[model samples]
Target: MDCIAMYIDGQWVESDSGNVTDIVNPANGRVIAQATRGTAADVDNAVAAAKRAFAPGSAWRTLTADDRAALMVKAADLIEARAEKLAVAETNSMGRVYRETRYDDVYAASGAFRYYASLVHELQGKASAENGDMMTVTVREPLGVCAVIAPWNYSMGTTAAGMAPALAAGNPVVVKPSSLAPVATAMMFEALAEAGFPAGSVNLVLGSGGEVGSALAAHPDVAKITFTGGTETGRDIIGRSATSVKRYSMELGGKSPFIMFDDADLDVAVDRLMFGIFLSQGQVCIAGSRLLVQQGVAERVLDMLKERVPKIRIGMPLDPDTEFGPMVSKRHMERVLDYIRLGVEEGARILIGGHRIAEGAFGEGYFVEPTVLVDCTQDMRVVQEEIFGPVLTVQTFADEEEAIRLANGTRYGLAGGVFTSDLGRALRVCSGVNTGIMWANAYLEDTAGMAVSPHRQSGMSVDGGLDGLLEYTVLKQINLKMTPAKSGWFAGME
Candidate 1:
């Protein structure tokens, strides 16, 4: 078996400690490869390399924006060319269905690189004409070395989300992918290398969050930290990076709301609502896990879901007919099961499926039935907290006011959706929801160049579009005297 080694300072090598972790195929519990277990020493080396490459006179620092963009485009092309291999690897390691990863994940990863590449030359500054004799101009400068920590669930796609923008802004990055799924991200760095990125400009360190992740966040040379993971872990990274006062860009946990009003097209609403909560087994940070419906139409929506949930296919990721795949691992599957138990214990009624599957074509795999909990109160733990699984809580509201209140009740505000044919109500309810991104009559409708962000505990900072590129840069102002210096005060003194 080929070992998946760490890619640091432009080379793939084994760990100095020779510590390795088994990379298991979550679909079948098979050990496919061994991954380098990076330590603090490994992190130190990667950061030092990134710092060196980002220094004033280094090759990466001297490259023009257009030249950098060309390299990024090349990397994106390479990724597109190898999309099939990358998708299969991601599905094998991350446990997402190949049907989803093959197209969505692969294309999104390549598109992110292409998106940021197009924006590299768009980093513009402002000039102020207010000062009569002085011309003031603002310049965007790279924030030097950055640490990019990506979660396991959407390994390569999320990694590219952070890596592309950081590179576009001319910042050297040291990436630490979750130990569970590091293969595809490593492949991404390889593509970058082939595209002629300067040595050490893009580095990968694979290990647990406690070891490599903490070291990278705390490193003095790292000027910024970009992370996407659970809220608790994000808080920990914040505290760890405090010593250096490093800038942070995070997309943390979310218990997003999906509301269905009485006037919404029942067919469209039901289809989208099912997809909103169940995609990627509800592992998405922006998953609409909390459903708030108007009382007049609540039962109808529940009936629709109850009939639709059973039709979803649950099997191995490689199965073309499969709609739902195994969870990331055995532990995560158990965590989700425990959350279901807690929901029942909290008085929420399980309307449909809510059990672990232990028999079938892939009995040993981590699989959970699509679950829906009804008769739920806003204060219930199942409704308020993020399950990060294929479980959703249903609640009913008497009026639009109550719906908005219930929707915004959670500590999270990452994303939400409001469905209704009444444009007036949709507009009003969308404005009332306290989320960073809101959907009207639709859910999870994403474009390439929009700024997708989180408002509350869901996270901080923008992760897409121009704002994302700006996160890796610092603004500096220059004031120039175009004419001779004024002498009124000096003349009076003379």
Candidate 2:
């Protein structure tokens, strides 16, 4: 309730220069509260705190795997107990439907914390094939100080995606939550500390992405940087990491395609398509921005979507009756509007809502009516670029090959889905799509099951499964020579 302050090194501290940024309610252009604006100096302090906590002599370094897991479980419990309040703040800030904040986001964060917590003791090493008396082995070691940069759309969920794994791997973290939704993240950290984490183990800072964010990415002490945001921002961060050659993992921007084949269940596919893009007012990274529908089913699916996308109630997140909320900010909402305009100008047909939803009985808020554009082309900016709003651009495909071509046309490979009754087609499309993850018969859904990125844009690692835990650690190889033999050291011994 109080104006939120940043948490750093087990203490709540305001910005060193007394800078502050107002947290606005996107539903209406109203300043909900003001948080202390973080700066480069703040990043320095947080990074230093993480460094010390990850140092060889620090208390955090000596904790047992069970001890770390215990803390994660405790933090999740605390968040669960306060789910109502946390859900309200998160929904208000990010414009998720109440059911989502109350169930999807909060539950996922809780499950992730527990999932990574369960992985603490699972960091097992392997013994390699040995020759004679010589032996070799590989073990995973902590990456030391980790800097996590989270996005505004799913502030808590994305924060958990990076932080939980790092903490589970025994690495200390310096967290930079998106300034747009700092209050909820600060609250989450407060819960983390309350669960008895050591001092300097977790820290939070708030500010514009370009300022404190760049400092976090480029800091010499930060051993790893995990980021989730726009692709250009990810590119910039990767470039910045060159200064220190730090290890980095990115869940960058996605323009995931939602493909529906002629054989798919029209009712189910249409429902998921509506939910996939319009759930958080279409402000999700994997929003299924490019909806690829087979030619035959296109008209039927479009009819169903036309009714579904608009019927979703657009109002205050706090209202129990409201099903959808506003976008994060007026600027973001305006940009989405501009994109809708561009889509029309580019010859994409407007099938459903495309303009801003004017003030209703509740009055002022940045609400855009759920917009759908059909007759989309692959080269169109609306299909190729990420439109992280509750807007859908539909494209018709002639067959499975055309669908695959249209789906893989975008540069993004974060996520996509295939809706079909034929198992062969489902398997074929799933295998053919150039994406980190592909779901059959579902869209915009996530599970603890992980996927490996075959391509580079989605990154070189995986999350959600056992492979996900590797992002927080490094692989080291050790060799032993029981024979005390040298490999022709003096050109004599062989």
Candidate 2, RMSD to the unseen true structure: 2.1
Q: What TM-score against the true fold does each predicted structure earn?
A: 0.97, 0.95
Give the per-residue lDDT digits (tens) of candidate 2, residues 1-494.
35678788899998877778888888777888888888999999998888888878788888989999999999999888878888888877766778878887777777778989988877888886558776888888999888889988888888988889999999999888888887778888988989989888999888888999999988889998888888789888888778887887788778888999998988898888878888788888777778898889888888888777767877778777787778888889899989999998999888888888775743487888888898888788998888898778888989999899988897789889999999999999999999888889987666565645524465545666678788788989899777775567576555
lDDT of 2 at 471: 70
How many clashes in each structure? 0, 4
Q: Which one is best on TM-score?
A: 1
- Scanning candidate 2 in windows of ten residues, the lowest lDDT window is 451-460
Q: Which stretches of candidate 2 lie over 4 Å from their true place?
A: 361-363, 452-460, 481-488, 491-494
Clashing pairs in 2: 27-365, 281-390, 282-389, 282-390
> Which runs of model 1 end up more than 4 angstroms from their true locations?
129-133, 483-494
Model 1 score (lDDT) = 0.89
